[model samples]
Target: MLHTIKQYFNRKGLRDPEYEFLFEPYTGEEAVSFDCETTGLDVHHDEIISIGAVRIRGNQILTSEKLELFFNPQQEMRVESIKIHHLLTCDLVDGVPLEEGIRQFLNFIGNRPLVGYYLEFDVAMVNRVLKPMLGITLPNRQIEVSGLYYDKKIAAIPQGNVDLRFDSIMHDLDLPPFAKHDALGDAIMTAMMYVKLQHIKYLEKF
Candidate 1:
């Protein structure tokens, strides 16, 4: 099934070679900001309910190029998870099947590096689906905004060491207000942080 999907994409001229990052100067153009809402935080046991992503080029979000997918989970959703993402099982009537959603997500991402908050877990959930269904792993580089903010802060403030909490970064950076755990809201916040960090990087260089 996965092979046929890949072949279809290839036939449509959608397959691109993987990206190689040389030891060159950094630029913000080649990044895709993404976020996932799941049935729970446990990547080992929980399931993804929906995913949203936007490609950021030159510090601008290409809204027209965004990808949004809702996946029907194999497991039943816990009450707590539904309260968080608001995706009831009944709400997923139009959602794509898990396999098809994964295939579309993989094709949308292609070889672009991913940007998100605590990205490893999302990547793990995505790979969990792929490894079983497609017999392949996710093949994109990832950048965590949480880690990047921490590194930037540690470099900027040598004397004041502070843990990098999401709320802390949001407050410190004067980022826009957001709903605590909404997938699309988080994705937009992550995109905003990425753009702000690029400006900070530029300042440090100049």
Candidate 2:
């Protein structure tokens, strides 16, 4: 089945040879939940200052083995952005360069499916740097925690509308709120959310 999907993507020009390994059969035994703190929200222009990820296996989050990296951005730090992540300019001066940081990140994540809250933005930020060095963006599968929560909430009570805010979902699910806006903190929070969402009463499939 995975081979067929890879063949289809290759024929359609969506598969990059460099990323072929990501299309191999997935055991579904584990996934990585990741988050990034960027210079700004603009995926095309902003740079990632920090990245954090933890592994999830069989409903257990492995906090011991993880990746947390910080990078120096080419662009000057914006005051508004600093307030959010608190990664000051001085703090990033000793940080790793973009290519090296991302290289380590990719190595750490391997081919595991990625999970997070509003995850595409983080993926885009990483890809912006990756395409240049690797000739391909991350080809791994992605899962969004918020989308899962929304699906479960709606299915439980079809007409019931739930606040999708990070804090709101954490509150409703009885998950402890972590420090907001920091990459590692957010990654940990999303990991916990993913575990809880897995147990929610739902449709036939996860």
Candidate 3:
């Protein structure tokens, strides 16, 4: 279908053939749950400062093996953003360059499907960096935890609203609130939500 065509073009125009494995059909069950801390919400102009991801295979979350990467933005982060992400420019002074961090991330993820909460923004942020460097965006399939939650939740109350806020969803799922909302912590928590949601059948009654 569309992906098959995109894959063909991506393979044909690949900047580095060494990354050809990315175009390879992923036959594995693993999905990477990832999150990125960024300078701002605008995907057109903002930059990612750090990325955190973990792998989930079947029902198991492999917490022992995880990817946590920080990049040197080399500019002062906005005070409001720093308040939320707690990643100041000073803290990332020794962090790796954006391209290096991105390479490490690509290696860590391979071709696994990606799962996340509000995943579109993060994917957009990564694609902005990836499109120029690789001549293609991530070909990995995406599973949005919030979307899964909505499908599972709206079965009983088709006319009612479902609060899709991160905290509200976590609370409804009975998962523990994260101590602080960093990229890794949020990614891990979102993975938990994904796993739990997979086991829950949609009930007709609330």
Candidate 4:
């Protein structure tokens, strides 16, 4: 009921008529797992330097059809942030404008639900522009990999503390070593976590 109310305002606030498709009903079962590499963690001030996402149809991750975009930042990036994403400003010279990148992302994602490790922050970062440009936040459903993992853990250990750390979850799941640490790499890995968790849920029913 709360989501319906919020989505009502989101649709009523539409500033761009062309994006009306975003509000359309989605019958497809596919979802997109995405990640954003920003200049910093501060969504209020930091900028998204790059975005990456992959489509998931059923239990399979369709890596061949993926979206990877880089945005050229007008300002310099901090040293601490560089250590995190390893993306230097010089490497973004070929990137598209930030708005263009966001537009492409919206088109690529369409009405599909979003999946991610820490999705709220990434959505907030994108909404920084989306609200001003289109007067709407992403209306797509969100599936958090960590939240899913937490549900599984808490079911097993209701009183025990659950480690929601990315590395910890990856280790517990026995997933493969994914060393790229880039936006796309993280998205792909998070997709694996989502699919594995879904499988675990199915297996638990028996």
lDDT of 3 by residue, 1-206 (tens): 99788777867877988788877779988999999998888788888998999999899889997999988884567778888898888888888888888889999999899999899999999989888988888888899999999998898678888888999888888889888999999889999999999999863432
| Alpha carbon deviation, residue 151, candidate 3 (Å) | 0.4
lDDT of 1 at 153: 78
10 residues in a row with least lDDT, candidate 2: 10-19
Q: After TM-score superposition, what is the CA distance of residue 112 in candidate 2 from its true location, in Å?
A: 0.7
- Number of clashes recorded per candidate: 0, 0, 0, 0
Worst 10 residues of 4 by lDDT: 197-206
What overall lDDT, based on C-alpha atoms, would model 4 receive against the true structure? Answer: 0.90
Residue pairs clashing in model 3 are none
Q: State the C-alpha lDDT per candidate.
A: 0.73, 0.82, 0.88, 0.90
Model 2 TM-score on a 0 to 1 scale? 0.87
**lDDT score of model 2?**
0.82
lDDT of 1 at 85: 75
Question: Which residue pairs show collisions in model 2?
Answer: none
**Candidates by lDDT, descending order:** 4, 3, 2, 1
Q: Clashing pairs in model 1?
A: none
* Local error of candidate 2 at residue 189 (angstroms): 0.7
